[model samples]
Target: MSSKLEQKIAEFRITFIAEFNDKLAVLTKLWSNARTSQSLEAVKKFRFEVHSLKGSSGALNFLTLSNRLGIIEEKIAPCEEQINSLKTVIPFIDRHMNSMNEASRNTPNSLLVLQEAASLLGELRDPQKNKEEITPQSYRDIKIALIDDNENTSAVNAKLLAGFGFTINQFNSIEQLEKVLQKNTYNLVLIDTDNSTNPSEKMFAFAVKLRTFDTDVFILSSSSSFENRLSAVRSKVNEYLLKPVNITTLVSKIRKNFKIDLIRPYRILLLDDQALVGSFYKTLLEDEHVEVLAISKADAIMTELESFHPDVFLLDMHMPNISGLEVARLLRQQAKYDYVPIIFLTSDDNIKTKLEVLECGADDVISKSTPPNIIVQQVDSRIQRGQEIRYLASRDSLTGVLNHGQIMDAAAHSLRLSKRQEKPAVVVMIDLDHFKGVNDKYGHLGGDKVLVSLGQLLLQSVRDTDYVGRYGGEEFMVVFSNATPRVIESKMNNILTAFLHINYTVDKQSFNCSFSAGLASSTDHEKLSELISSADAALYQAKDAGRSQICVDVLNK
Candidate 1:
């Protein structure tokens, strides 16, 4: 039995090597044909063959074989270049074919070399072929049905596939195929055209009906003529192989179509603990396209969160080590990941819990019982909203500067810390003098344009550490941290001078605008309000004395 097994293994290796030679010949023929014809149709067909063989060769780990093919592809790089025609490409294909043929015949260890060549050629043809080796899966229980009036063809095809470890069913008629299909779900179906006199029309009609059975169809054709091929494609056959078919070619087609690539399903940590609910959610998330990772373990939250940078999270509210709120909070505390969105998935309808979860920095809160479609929508909406909020929070919606509120809040915090460290903070209050006149003259719209311009000017004038804000309409506040009185006064004066020369156009008339300024020191007052108020008094003095002048009020005078 062991000796028999050894013989089978040796035979299989010989067959594999032989098939490699056949693929090489086929590739050369296609390439040479493509070069000779130099038609768009020929190139398209050649590309299809190259792509298919690349996938097969990569699967078989024929790197060197693939790379040599890649050399042909690269030489024919600009496939659209009509200038050269097939003259150069045809010779290249012929040479490569000859070299591969010689290597296959003479070298004993050439099989390994040929395999490597195939892999390289495959990689050259498709960069994605560089993926890790795939294990050919063993199928102990895969049920499939074969539908064809030709019993001999059906049995032969089934036996060939069965050798590759597929469990197949052979049926002689559409009626028999339908009966088996009603009882079993098949990964594939094989249909033969030999028995039907008007095969193409009948095959097309049968394919339309068989689609309802959810089985992929593989058509067996006696020839690869354009008429037959067109009908096969129109019927949406997963594969169409010409007969007296090469069993290896049939096996390759079955393996290519029926074999699952076994891509690891994306590991998603679903924080929900609900039993079938979590699995249902997972199933819904798994579109035919993406891998999904769904887990219900509440305790391994950190581990899961760390390992899987999920496209999204469906985090449940009530978990053991930490509530979803706490988890979200912890996620936000990490500097590297604070912005990662955590959507709270909860069944709790309590408004308070929802609010708390949101306040704890959850990107969004979604109901556990939310529809799968709604969940996807919510996830998308949450990501979009988070981005918008981040932008709005840092920006002034009106003038597009830092908003006065945020600026003041930042200033207050920074001022407190600076004062604790015995550092000085200079505060300046800027009032746009006669700004009301701009509105009155140009309408509010023109005034808005001026205000926006002023915001830009102020933003540009400030140092990196200096903060500016729109205090109120026509009033701006600036806080200069670590500035001495002299430096603050110089900067304030420069700003006033810059505004005096700023030319604004309105109604085809040029207008030069100016602003009144005020200054105070952090040493004068600990509170931002107090410093602002003192600066306001200085500003009043500037307005009272005459507009467009700077004033400093050491005391409220």
Candidate 2:
């Protein structure tokens, strides 16, 4: 095989291994959980992993592997059978996964075995069907209303949606539509701007009211006028379909705007001097719903930028001539693009240079010294941060945490995730004991040094998935998802030990600062305010019983 194809195969093997590793980790965690909740979560996670692998293998044209994975996914989705069933299959699955890892371009028998296993899965689902089993559906019954004065357009649009299993309501005018909306609840409302009372004004008012019901509002217009599209967007229309809509495009827009199986592929731009580097990144990123743009030269970046408006810029900082930092600066300066996040990849071990590049506008500076997996993770984090910033308010300058208002928003988000995942998520409330005494003893600058050290320490020690925010002056809150009381206590102990080591210097004079933390888990359904209150009560207890120690209070102390 040629070198390029060989590299591609190697990358695929790595991705397959990583995915299996992730599933194994999740399965291990599920097995260790309490019996009451074990199967449900384990089954869900297992199914999700297998389903993901099925699609991935299918896309790669690994028919046998895809088919087998499909069967495994189906079996695990309804893992209601005893845990012994899993125990029995887990060993076989592990061996098969290992076989995939060992198999090469010449391993046809392994492929045949995978195919047979896949075929057997269909038999398990329905013994009669000798064919592949269709995956179970989770289609939601969505009610949508279309308002258009034109009879022909409304009928055509409604009929098109009916084929997709949507229940459609048709209205001839704004007045009729208003009455229908008031009388019935709809998931989405489609308005034809051409037939509105005052296209701009009425559309805006309708959008506000429709949004109150949390329904998606969309505009259908034949005008195709830029002004009309702008007005529709201003009126908070989720999307606008131009007149003489192609049925496919219209259906796609409807499904996409409504988030109905409209999964977007992640877009990754890989810039490197080496063709192998770009190809490797492309292969890895493509497996995760990503569109990879591999460019080898800094000069060709503009061409790629024009054709592919990538969500992220993964630029090589060591590129000749105009470096990644230079390109990043240019991109940020452009009026068309300043929001696009840039992550620079460098082999240089110098931290000072890396910090300078970050200051130059790169969102993240990742070392090429790390593994490819770490590189992918760092890129994912940078992209996730950009997405999160849209929903989060400005972070606090002092504590580097979400300010007062943003904390509630983050708490609510963590709460929902905790409940859905059925995992333990904890909130740790921390307060500096005798904070005022320290400020008085060491001066305000010394107090500031302590807070900065605490922030840095927390960010460094916590898991990447965990969130830490400055709740207020001398107080911080941590959102620890998928964490237990013991795990959280261990983390807190580390924090206390680390805090003791931090040497705070003010005016070249050294000083010391200490803190106490209290943790409460989200095992029960409690409000965000209530979770914090419980944590705060525990914090008080820790403070009352000598500070600088971690405490977990089950009683609402």
Candidate 3:
């Protein structure tokens, strides 16, 4: 068989074993309780547990184990009727439970036990079906409404959001918005408050109306005045953005409020020589929704490790060609996987052995007898910490966007891609309008909020394929792939329109903020620096034209 196919089967085996182990653990407990209680209810519970185990084991292709469990379940079936005959049933229960435990410890022996148990029970039918079970349904469809008078702004926002799998409906008037809200449910309502007279009152009333329908509201306004912010607070607006809002920030806010994560499942690489033991560990991790790749041959470990890019490594101490300690050392030599957790699983309880393993680069040592729940918890904790560390290293501390170096690196990569594909990529230099004035008026804390808000806006506005970053204080940058100068300008304009409506408050005083952006496309320059410089120059022109507008650089071909 092909290595890939073999690996796939091994992975499935691991997952099945993990699940079976958990079921067995529960069955062990239930059996013990049933024996002591000797009640009809206890017997029924035991039967149900065994029945479930039979079905699951069968579904996972553990036919031997399934058949054995099925026989045991069948024997317990008549226990409720023969509840008074507890003494007679207890011996049968104990015998089966001991056989099952022994079979679990040695999977190969399970078939022999199954045959013996079947003979004693007379006839045993297959408990597993041929087909796989259906997966549960995913998250429901997410729909949003973008209400704004500017058709250009609405269209751009709608297009960007639609790319994120949202159904967007545009509305130019409150009446039109109300009509849609009354007729259909929307996950979120994004309204442009720039045209409203008494924007605060209008927003509050609109929010009140939305609340009746249990809809989330986001307001877009050019003014960040005290009254407006207070109104948003009163109306419990989910998000308040200034006109020319960052599309990235808007999308992020929507996702945050809605609790959405695009990151895939945590991946784990398991290394063990014993197929059964490796499969068991793999199953344990998979039960926690982790993606695991199990490799029995030490020679295949590096290949699997490189391909899987696992967040954590589970290694068995004793192997044919290579020890777990040696594998950990080999992994540690690779700089990329340096911080990746290496957990050693072994039956060896020797203190000297564990210390030696740790010294050899294993992060933690787990006994083979460790409970499934504890194993999962330890692995999850380590993975989470690793992720958190990576996040902090890659993200801006305050705004939670890409830091300067990370953004530049991303831009460089995007530029390389653009050059290779011969596709146009645009970079926008963004500056918050009158940002210093905000600090002077409301202190640095308020200014920080404006910066954070803009950062969030830019992060949300850009496509997942695009890169947005905090360039420096009061400035940001967005790298858009396969975008023309005109398209970038239009999108930035839409962001500007939305950004102007963001409200900020300081000691009862409220104000709004705006931003000016300059767009430069890859067609203008071969280098990221040149593109950024051109964008910066155009951004100055935007400021000169008056704040809160997007300007495109007139690049000579």
Q: What TM-score, computed on C-alpha atoms, does each candidate reach?
A: 0.36, 0.36, 0.45
Pairing residues by index, what is the TM-score of model 2? 0.36
List the lowest-lDDT window of 10 residues for candidate 3. Answer: 130-139
Candidate 1 overall Cα lDDT vs. reference? Answer: 0.63
Instruction: Name the candidate that leads on TM-score.
Output: 3
lDDT against the true structure, per candidate, is 0.63, 0.64, 0.71
Model 3: residues >4 Å from true position, as ranges?
1-362, 365-372, 409-427, 462-467, 479-491, 519-538, 551-557
Residue 128 in model 2: lDDT: 29
lDDT of 3: 0.71
lDDT of 1 by residue, 1-557 (tens): 12333343334335556666666667668766776778766775565555444433322344555556556555554564563565666677678767976887776645644544222222223322222232323243456677767667676667655543468878777766666666778767777777655557777777767777766787876767898778767777677876777654564455335433222322344665544445545554453233456666766766654334454556767644456777677777864355456777654445887789779877667654343345655665554454334334654655555676677776785577568768888788888888888898866655665676676577767775677788888888888877776787888788778878766655555676788988888877878788878888888989998888888876622
Clashing residue pairs in candidate 2 are 222-243, 266-289, 266-290
Top of the candidates by lDDT: 3
Model 2: worst 10 consecutive residues (lDDT sum)? 129-138
